[model samples]
Structure formats: structure tokens, C-alpha cells
Target: MTKNHNSQHKDLMLQNSQKLDRLLTRLCKRSGCDEEEEHEGGNESVLFIAAKNGVLEILEKILKDKPGAIHETNSLDQNVLHVTVENRQPRVFEHLEKYLKEKELWESHVARADKDDNTILHLAAKLSRYKPRHIAGSALQMQWEVKWFLFMKKKMPHMQFLQNKSRKTPQDIFVRDHEDLLEQGIGWLKSTSESCSVVAALIAGVAFATATTFPGGTQEETGKPYLERHPAFNLFAFTPLWALFCSITSLITFLSILTSRQQPQDFRKDLPSKLLVGLSYLFMSIASVLASFSSAFFFLLRDHLQQVVFSLYAVAILPIAYFGVAQSPLYMDLMRATFRNIPQSSNRESEKLIL
Candidate 1:
């Protein structure tokens, strides 16, 4: 009896496989299925053919029978959805969305990118030639991703940032194409983009310099440099100290601003102002680091090795600054994501109509 049961199970599995294949074949041959063969000259494939005919009903049946069929890659190693997008057929999305919605494919496939490092969202955005349909469709797809992300966030509150193979967060890529949407929906919620106005380090320096005095040329018992009580210390002591403090404080704050995410409101209002803000901070940081080193060299350089060390360190400053400048564009995009809004489907549709 056990042997009979095992044989029956095997036979049933084989039957199911055959049934699935036949369903796929029938779906492929439906009306409006002029899609090219698997290795044919045109862009369409069998999976695309099934999708293009508005035969989503049959496609759904096949998918239900053989769930893994969607994972099959073509000669280009692209998943079915990727092929669907490449074909630029709106009807393909109709069937694909149905399959995805029924299967809850959003969370499962959210991070998947095709051969060209393009995610489904990326493909949708690239379907620009299809205009209003593609724009509206892509927005829906993005909304699905955002919903899935929010669901995951609720379930896993500790999830700080989601990273992909490209070392980018979903927000990173999303903001690149939909900056305003991100800012409106999510960017304002984070505090990393707020501006800092106080020059903190400079204030501290001024206070320190005001407290010291060289009095009466009397060397202390410790044989160290002593202050001979002088009125000059009382009057000008606070001035040098304050200047030094302000310089240092300004420098640190400037560096912080440069490295911080650029605010979208600022960038959108005036590109030059945003740029000047960055340049001002970068310049201040460099000058502050240099002034600190120079002060240490003149007043605190205790040994010959210190001079050599400062010189060697100075050599690295420009190269480091250059690399930081090179990465400015990427960080600018990230900052914009925090404050910018993505255009809505209706607006994009209207724009397409205008075009």
C-alpha cells in the first residue's frame, strides 16, 4: 500500500507539470499574441506574449499551477517582469500587476534588480516613452514599495536603513527619481538636515585666552614660562583667545555642514546659494584645521618631529578634500531626498499631455 501511494504521488506531480506547460502554451497562442519566439528577432517573448494579449486570466491560472514559472529568465537572464518592461507594452503591466498583487510579490521582489542593475522601479521610470501610462503605472508600483517598506518598519522598528547590493538604501534610489515625493512623505521627519548657526569652538578659545597673564617676569618654582603681571594680559588676552576660538568653531561647523545632507528647499530655491553655502563651510574647515596646526607649531611645537608630522599631514588635506568634493553630487541627491517632493501621477500625466 505504501509503494502504491508513493507511485501515485509521483504520477500526480508529473501530471501537474504537464498541465502547467499546456496552460502556458495556450496562453501564449491567445489573440493579439504576435510576440516573437524565445530566440526570435523581435523583443517579445512567450511570457510577454501571454501578458500582451490581456489574457491575464490564463496567465494567472498558469502561475497558480506553477508558481516558480515567473522566476524563469530569458536568454538575457531577465525575469518575466523585466522582459515585460523592456517590451514597453502597457497590457503587459496589466497582467503583471495582477500576478504580483495576487501573489504579494511586492515585498518578495522589492529589491530585485535585473542585468543592468535596474530594479522594477528603475524600469518603470525608464518607460518614459510610454508617457502618461508609464508614469501613472510607475507611481503605483512605487506606492506599493513604499507601503511594503512601511509595513516592514512597523514590524521591525529597529530597522535603521535597508541596504542593497549597490550599498544604497531604497530612499537613496527613490529620491534620485522622485525627490519631492520623498521630502514630502519622509524627509521632513528626519532631523539630520537641520542647519547649525553657532560657531561653537571659537567661543571656547576666546574664553581660554582671556584667563592667562604673564606677570612681573617672575619665573615660577617649576622653572616654566611665567607671566610677569601686566595690564596687556588683562586687555588683549580675551581678544586673541576669542579670535582663535571663533576660527576653530567656525571651521568645525563648516565641515559639519559640508558633510551634512543638503536641504532640498535650499537647493531648489537657488542652486548657487546652496553651492556657496557648501563652499563656505569647506573653506572654513580647511582654514580652521590649518590655523589650529599653525598655532600648535608656533606656540606648542615641543619637538622637531612635530614639524615633520604636521608637514606630512598637510599633504593629505587637499587629496581628502578633492575626494569629498567628488562625492558631493551623491550626497546632494541624498539630502534632496530628505526635503524634496515627488511629482504626483496626475501632474505627470498632465505634463505628458502637454508634451
Candidate 2:
């Protein structure tokens, strides 16, 4: 019976998309259960397998077939809710909440404790045993980590003060489990900041030199720029000024990342948020430098450089695009998830979105 159940679960996970009714019948027959009986046993049940593997379709079908299975526990005595949180399955997490509420099992199962006297909140705190690639990278990975811990904390307020069998609170477990990721995060942030600082310093130097060299030379008498009245010269003057300011701002922010205290809380909102702002400023500075260079180039070569304009613009965009494509996902994810007022759940399903 166990062998048959494992085989069926493996097939379902492999995406053998039979109708729920037909699949249930086959599972019943293969396991030697009569029609209309819920498949039973820990880890062997369809519900537990679906929750553990993040197969939301199979989970929903199992729930509809045997709503009681929503409360089923594995060898560790954790229900589907606990498994979903521990697995960090976003889609299953969202759908399960709705299912639990419709069936009125939120309180019984959500706060339900496992064998170690650890609730779903406790499971959420431990560094995941399974890492999903959908999370992008370590920076965003840590952000989502904090986000889930906070979500679970809010969902179960009493969980904040609750201690498990080991006598450690959820916060303690969270801080401890995340130690390695936090160090990795710090390394990522510092390296990112260091690289940006170099780029910013480079821009500052180029902008300074461009201003001193004065695109079309200076007037012999007044020491004024020669093309002071031309619109392109106005662009040349304004863009470098903007670039210099932005790069300086970026440099300061990245410098702060270098000096920030690498605490667990720092990863939550302090260091990462500042890194996001720094990256934004650096991006703007790079854009400003491109504009300044193009405008100055036009001023210096108006008579000779008309044909090469398009090619030159394309060349300038390559580096800018490279930096953007490489870093935009982390920036977008951090911006969207951090610094927001997350709504708390009280026996109600909160609509969860992927970061």
C-alpha cells in the first residue's frame, strides 16, 4: 500500500494531469481503498505530498475530496499549512489560506503545533531546507525570508512570545537560522557598493575633466565657454552638473553600505534599503554621464561627427543596458517588497504576491 501510494504521488508530481475524480479512483484502487474513502497515512496521503511538493492543483483536489485531510499531519505532525510555510511555496501558501477559510480550519491548522511544539511560525523562521530558484538571488532571498517571518509573526501575534521545546522564541530562531545568509548578504551588498563607488568615482573624475576642458574652449577675454549660447552647450553644461551631483550622492550611499553594522535587523530594512537607493542614484548618474558625453561630443564635432551619431549613441547604451539587466531584478524586488505596510491576517486569507 505504501509503495502504491508513493508511486501515485510521484506520478502526480510528474504532472500526470488526470481528472481529479479519475485520479482519486485510481489512487483508491491502487491503495486498495473502497470508493468515496479518503486516502490516509502520513506523508503517503495525497494532501501531504501536494503541500510538501507545492502542487496546488493536487492539493485543492485532495482538499475537495477529503476536507479532513487539510488537518492531516506528516511524521512530524505538521499539517498542510505548516508544510506550505516551511517550503516557502508562494502559490500554495496563497491558495491554502483561501481554502482554509472557506472550510473554517484556519485556527485549528494555522496555529497548530508540530511534534517539537513548533507552530507554523516556527517553521517559517528556520532557514528553508529547500531553496527555490524563483527567488532570484541572495539579496532578494534574504528579503523574502524577513518578509515571511514578519508575515507569520503578524498572523500569529502570540507566536512572537511563544517558545518552542528548545526554549527559543521565533525571533531567536530566525536570527540564528539566518546567520549564514546574513553574512552572504553583507558580502553581496559590500561588493556591489564597492563596484558602484568605483564607477561613481570614475564619473566624478570624467565630469570634472570635461568641465575643466570646456567642450569648445573658452573665450580669450572673459574666460567664458565659447559656445555658451548654443543649445547643445546648455545640454553639455547641465548634464555634467547633474551627473556630478548624482554620482556624489551615489558614492555617499554606497560608502554607507560599506560601514553599516551587519546585524540581522540591518538586512531586514536598513542596509538593503540604502543599497536600493544607492543603485538608483548610480543608475541616474550613469545616464546623466551618457547624456553629457553625447552633448559634448556633438559640440566638439558638429561639423565632422554627424554620420557617427547613431553609432556612438548605440555604443554608449551597451554598458548602461548591461548594468541595468544585471541588477534590475534585485532592485525591483526590494523596492516592491520593502518599506510597505503589510496587512495582518486574523483568521482571514491575505492575498500573497511573489516578490
List ranges where model 1 is wrong by over 4 Å: 1-192, 195-267, 275-279, 306-312, 315-327, 330-355
Runs in model 2 with CA error above 4 Å?
Answer: 1-42, 336-355
Model 2, span 2-55: residue lDDT tens: 999999998987664445545554444443343214333322566654555565
TM-score of each model, paired residue for residue? 0.26, 0.79
lDDT digits (tens) for residues 86-147 of candidate 1 = 33434445556676778888445545666556555444433232222232122233343343
Residue pair clashes in candidate 2: none
What overall lDDT, based on C-alpha atoms, would model 1 receive against the true structure? 0.45
* Candidate 1 to truth, TM: 0.26
